[model samples]
Target: MQEIFDENVFKKGIGRQINLPFLKAVSTAFKNIRVRFGRSFITIGGIFFSLTFLMSTFTNNVIAQSLLASGTDEVKFLLQPMAQEVQARQVWLISLSLLVCIIGIMNAMLTSVTERYREIGTWKCLGALDRFIVELFLLESTFQGLIGSIGGAILGFLFPLFVNIGKYGTQVIEVLPWLEILKYGAITIVIGLVLSIAGAIYPAYRATQMVPADAMRQEM
Candidate 1:
């Protein structure tokens, strides 16, 4: 009679043998971004434009004030009450755009999970664990978030600056609120990172639940 294999001992041995490297997951994430640029672009664009909207809303008044004149003292006094109203509206707009951004990211990543069914199975068949798969997707989102956030931040500030310079000349840059701008930029970047990662979590969990046999049988 054949000797029985101890399942628990076998599992312990396999666990000890597997070593997943962080660099490997990071490299795979970069490769996937390049190989799937079109999808990656869509995901990044959602974050990019959303952050752009946010940054513009954030600094619109500050830049406008520096470039435009309030006229007589009476005009400044008249607009004071209205500023709060305008800011409240902007807050609503920002909140809406960010919600859409989060949804867009989740949808795009879900698509990726479906598309990579065979790839996921191949990795699983080769002894890849669920944690490795999750890590790959998270890294992809992190990089996308970083690029989109930085690009959006630059464009958001530069576009406004260009428009103001055209309309008001160089004076706009001279009196610029650099400190406030930097603070908003940093805050926006953090938001982008958190949103990107948040959007990927569900899809990553879905991917981890895939059965290797079924996933491998998937058409695409």
Candidate 2:
């Protein structure tokens, strides 16, 4: 009724390198994402929304500063630097958004662990190590985060730009800090990746602790 790992093979493998390749873990992560499309979508969307808000505010602030630095009387009439209190409020909002996104991701991953009880058990039975399980979870979250953050960063940057263009005319494009925008975009992407990986850490650790027999017996 049940097939467990071969005791002899398990015993022999104790002295050898049996950890799965990183590429294999990555492949499995991709498959998991494809299989759990809806959950993956929500997880990615949360990351996207958070990063979009972050990038948009930063872009807007940068735009205001650039317009001011242009030394045009028009800039004074058209835009004003954000007040200190306003900037502080925006910072609070951004921090809250990111925190919510991380919590959402953590919940999604934990649900995944519960749903894939049998699958995880099978992997362990076939010699998959705890580290492999952890790697898979991290890879999954990172992939989702990478896609979401990149999309968010581009959308966030462009949306404010378009709005500014309407307000300041196409000439406003010439005044933007292109180099600075690129730098911030790069930093935002890194933050997204770190955020997703951090969210998955606890879930990944949970996956590693599953007992093969108990997990296989679980009903998803």
lDDT by residue for model 1 over 12-63, one digit each (tens)? 7687644579999999999999999999999999999999988877767677
Candidate 2 per-residue C-alpha lDDT over 131-211 given as tens digits, one digit per residue, 9 for 90 to 100: 999999999999999999999899989999999888888766988989999988998899899999999999999999999
Give the C-alpha miss distance for residue 51 in model 1, angstroms.
0.4
Q: Could you tell me the TM-score of candidate 1?
A: 0.86
The list of candidate 1 runs beyond 4 A from truth reads 1-9, 64-82, 166-169
What are the clashing pairs of model 1?
none
lDDT value, residue 124 of candidate 2: 90
Report the lDDT of model 2 for residue 63.
Answer: 82
lDDT of each: 0.85, 0.89
Cα lDDT of candidate 2 equals 0.89
After aligning candidate 1 to the native by TM-score, how far in Å is the CA of 8 from where it should be? 4.2
